[model samples]
Target: MSPIIENFEKSVNTLLLVSTLVATVTFAGAFTVPGGYNSPGKGFYIFVICDSIAMYSSIIAAVALIWAQLGDVTLLLDALHLAVPFLGVALSMMSMTFTAGLFLAVNKLR
Candidate 1:
């Protein structure tokens, strides 16, 4: 219950909230693949890949947070640090997904 531990908890809580929101958004995205509502699309694979990465990374972050809560005080920092890579991957994948969608749109318009 030191100030440092308290601050760490606050940060972890923030990360948990963010990871959960990402998971929710990706979960929703999974059900609504790109361009499916309008026309046949070639970016379904990109959408699925990005959604999978986002969903799994967010889940991993959540699990790491939960696990951190159950162990030594130092575990929280380690968990968050470890989770950073997953978040990075998710972010890159999400960017790629958008790029793929944009490319598809350009191609379709041509």
Candidate 2:
């Protein structure tokens, strides 16, 4: 492997781990919803939407990372570019999901 590819491998490994974790957590969050199913407020809807987005985006990023493993320089670069942005989107959405879930949970106490 070239030095460039080797460098990318390290990054790919890190990103793959992150995307996988985000996907798993978001998938779980989808089921164990905050405020329960009985009360569907704005925060509940926001949590649902953001959780779905985070889960799907992270799954896509994981797929892209798998593609990056093909070992072709051009393909690896393309896949990395695609995966990184999706990973970022997944992470941001995950944060939004957490905030929304918190809001829903806290609001339920009022």
- The lDDT per prediction is 0.75, 0.91
Q: Which is the leading candidate under TM-score? A: 2
Show where candidate 2 strays beyond 4 Å: none
Poorest lDDT segment (10 consecutive residues) of candidate 2: 101-110
Over 4 Å off, model 1? 37-42, 102-107
In TM-score terms, candidate 1 sits at 0.78
Residue 6, candidate 2: alpha-carbon lDDT: 94
How far does residue 23 in candidate 1 sit from its true spot (Å)?
A: 0.7
* lDDT of model 2, residue 43: 86
Error of 2 at 70 (Å): 1.3
lDDT (10s digit) by residue, model 2, range 67-94: 8888788888898999999999999999
RMSD, candidate 2, Å? 0.9
lDDT of 1 by residue, 1-110 (tens): 79988888888887778777777877887776656655555576666777788789888988888777775887888998977677677667667766766665566563
